[model samples]
Target: MLKIGEVARRTGVSVRALRYYEEQGLLTPDRTPSGQRRYPEETVEVVLLFQRFYAAGLSSRAIAALLPCVNKGHPSTPQRHMLRTERDRLAARVEEMADTLHRLDQLITDADRRAGAAA
Candidate 1:
């Protein structure tokens, strides 16, 4: 077992964030007799997964809801639906970001061409 601080250090997450994960039902650390939090060694990977989920725009509640599916290696019907929905949303966001990047590239090319002509 690792202490909460050790988990945070290994995962590069804050102690406060780990506590928040517990509050959100995302992590369940064991408590010592003195009430200090002790986590399993696997918690580092779990915290990294939580960071990825957060980057993917999942709320804490969403992550909490999906944890069981993740642990079971299979999602229920509603969980499957939710996964699909989030995936579609992420796909659209990626497309939009790509389009924006293309537009910015075009603008930069145009500016470069204009600068070359002026010189």
Candidate 2:
């Protein structure tokens, strides 16, 4: 067993975030003898999952709706298909960000070159 602080450190997440996750029902840590929070070993994996889904642009309510936060199969085929579509959307967003970054870099370089030539 580990304390919530330890879990947060191991997961590279903040204690407040972990508590929020718990409050959101995505994470359920047990209480210690003194009412402190204690997490099981598998909690590390769960926290990583939460981090990934969050980074993938999922809101708490959206993640709670999709992930279920429990160890069970999904409800129906539609849910599965929806998850797949969301993943595809995330992939597209990644590509879009890369293109945007490239364009921004090109603009910066062009401006720098123009400034140097005018000087």
Candidate 3:
């Protein structure tokens, strides 16, 4: 078992965030007699998964909705649909970023060409 601070350090998540995750039912740690939070080693993975979902632009409510299905190793139809929607959003963002990169590359090339012509 690990204390909350230890878990936070190991997982690189803040103590407040861990507490928030507990409040959201994303994690349930054991409590010591004095009410200190004690988490199992497995909690590290859970925290990491939570971070990944957050990085993927999932809200806590969305993560909460999918948690049960994820735990069961199969997503229900609605859960799958939700996941697909999020995936599509991510794909669109990627395309937008690619376009931005292409524009920046063109700008850089044009500037370099102009500088060469001036020299």
Structural similarity to truth (TM-score) of each candidate: 0.94, 0.75, 0.88
Candidate 2, residues 30-69, lDDT tens digits: the string is: 8877999999998888889889988888888877777652
The C-alpha stretches of model 3 lying farther than 4 A from their native spots are none
> Candidate 1's residue-wise lDDT over 1-119, tens digit each?
99988998898999999999999999998989999888888888889999999998999999998898877869999999999998899999999999999999999999999999999
Q: Comparing 2 and 3 by lDDT, which wins? A: 3
In model 1, the worst 10-residue window by lDDT is 64-73
Top TM-score prediction, candidate number? 1
What number of clashing residue pairs does each candidate have, in the order they appear? 0, 0, 0
Clashing pairs in 1: none
Show model 2 residue runs off by greater than 4 Å: 68-76, 115-119
Shift in Å, residue 34, candidate 3: 2.0
